[model samples]
Target: MGGSFGANLRRIRDESGLSLAQLAAKINYSKSYLSKIENDLKPPTADIAKRCDSLFGTAGFLSAMVTAGERPDGDQDEDVADDEVWVMVAGDDGERRFHRLPRREVLTGVGAAAGFALTGGARAVVDEPTLAGLRTMFGQYRLLGTTSSPATVLAPVIAHVDTLRALAAAGHPESVRRQLLLLASRAAEYAGWMSQEAGDERAALWWTHRSVAFAEAGGDEHFASYALIRRAEIAMYRQDPLTTIELATLAQADRAAGARILGLAARCEAQGHALVGDRAAYRRALDRAAALLAEADPAVPVLGSSSVSDEVALADGWSLYDLGRPAEAAAALDRQFPGITASARRARARFGARRVLAHAGNGEIDHACELAPAVLADAAQVDSATVRVDLRELARVLARWPGHPAARELRFALGTALRVRPGSGG
Candidate 1:
């Protein structure tokens, strides 16, 4: 695959009439590095493949070639050791740092009794009140996550998961232990989402697997199904539509899974179908998702985005764009987007960027430009990698009208938001 990728890259570059130096300058790689890649001296990184694909309009062929030869991420079933714990220390400058240390080392350093007590001893009992408080705190953290960067919110969420897991491991009543572990699973799941937002898919998968482990320990059988939906999302971002559909379908195969989980899976399947321009399949999956969502139990905690009043509708709008119905996509998004809560900055930014792309694709350059600044502001605030996907597409669509003042200005802002160099094609 590496050699094939190099051959394809060289062929594409030659056909585009670009010298090694010229291609290197365009993609921000060194001439020597490009030379090595062309000679199969080094495997092409995913980042370089994307840049080259964007420049050459290969439609992700280069990226596909690179990822096809990669190894699996690793085992997802391994559990964190009971003897290992995360320790946090406060510095003189008020900065906090966390470290993972063995229980024996901590006991030796802090005294056995103190260390045992700090890490939740066997005598520790978590009651309903404590669980309720933790749940409330988790809700607050989720709300905070909406308005902040993932990097800012991730550490505290991970720490909270560790604390909950520690408590669950202590000798407590069965009901209380189950609830504690369930909460830990939910926290771990959120941490996985934050990891993805932070652009670390490997960490994202690890956290998601941990979430499944915690949930199973708590006797919850449904979360593993939910984890499949999460994996499908990662595949969706990677543009692997078939894998996304496969995972989402497998998630739905668990009949015991809640309506919320099934609905989310169905929604993911719709996205996969849309990605491949299968309008009929996309609509069918979307309709199924909408019906399931309407029938979902509100008493249960929300499994996905909570800020959007109608998640299926928002997804439908985005799918329209994917299906190449850009005019209708823009209208659908315009109608649905304002209904999303203002505090859900990340969601707004993500859908807003898609709306911009839809409008740009429909040749409404001015309206697309008009819609871009607010989206860019939200995108900059949230610092989301997922939202940047659509923002990059919006930049490309706007690039068609290079001389239009609004288009050029929006392109510059998009470039800044994406942190791409000038003339890099984003």
Candidate 2:
């Protein structure tokens, strides 16, 4: 149904020779809003369908499409079946396969269970194998977060979280129930992180809150503290250093937070200090974090298999960059980045963008320009607002040398990187 509606709408809109913005203006909507509908990221409402019908003189044809699309079997073209939503479902042999189905079908089937889960209804039994499968699926989704854009993975992550919550409420042994809750918390935390990267602050906050709740319910104080630290990270990205510092401090105050979480909180605090140009405080915070990180117990697991020392190093590099010590920043980042795998798309993109900024800061305009394209290429793979912000700032610096050939080329690249082209809306 999504495929059919999107295809039909795009065809009609193109044939009518109206750009997305033009039609949106006629219909009293934003181009980005309409683009989401046309791209299947959002379902068309009856009002939108009616408006489209009137504009194209289709005599309610578009409205009918909307109505049909609400049904399970509506306009499902087999030729484009491959375009349907697919989710990873683990098999008995430790393999996973894509389970393709119409969106409506999956939603309808899962909604009741989700509601039951929320209401604490009578437990429904699920076997051990099924539980393992669900855990495997969560692991797969978490792995994807490193490589895929948030927009590409957000829906599936949400769906998986919903399913996990439902399973949590179902009949299970106490131990299994606790395990399920832990997975749900982790899922919510990942979703929150993704939302932050995608620039959805409210959603990120909401998901992070949910994560903390679940983690606490599961008696995982470490994860709860981690969620607060994640929230601090979000504040930092938004350039709210005060809020970042406050949240980081709050997380550190949690007695249950271990050495690794303490290190994370300290790192967050250090970033805040760096942002405000408190060199002494920043250095003290970095040293404190490094000390705690070195003493973190090996038994305690941090999210994403991240090493405390590695994280502190990256944060220290960022602090150096923010404090306007570009050469030192470059040296620090150069030492750290090679240890980061190419598969870690978000990390690599972020560090690479900062590296470009470091070069530009040191008056190495040509070198910066030489590196910008590759950095942007990798950064484009993740829907990370933080990376975009860094690139934009670098562009502003490059703007000072407008006539320089390298600067000009970089500006052209920035225009392409930053602008929202037709059909590629937020």
Best by lDDT: 1
Candidate 1 per-residue lDDT, tens place, 98-130, comes to: 445685665444422443577665465567777
Per-candidate TM equals 0.75, 0.70
Off by over 4 Å in 1: 1-123, 420-426
Q: Where's the lowest-lDDT run of ten residues in candidate 2?
A: 74-83
- State the weakest 10-residue window (summed lDDT) of model 1: 71-80
Quality of model 2 by C-alpha lDDT? 0.72
Q: CA RMSD for every model? A: 8.5, 18.5
> Which clashing pairs does model 2 show?
124-171
Tens digits of lDDT, candidate 2, 1-426: 345777789989999999998987665556887899889888876546645765676644565676552433321212324223334444675433344567556655553355555667655566788778877887787678777677767767878776777677666777877777887888888877777777666667667777777777777867767877887787777665566778888878876677888887888888976654556777898898899888888775456335123888888887776654666777788788788887787788888889887777666788888878878877777757778888888887677676789898898888788774212543
After TM-score superposition, the amount by which residue 240's alpha carbon in candidate 1 deviates from its true location, in angstroms, is 0.7
After the best TM-score superposition of candidate 2, give how far the Cα of residue 173 lies from its true spot, in angstroms. 1.9
Model 1's TM-score against the true structure: 0.75
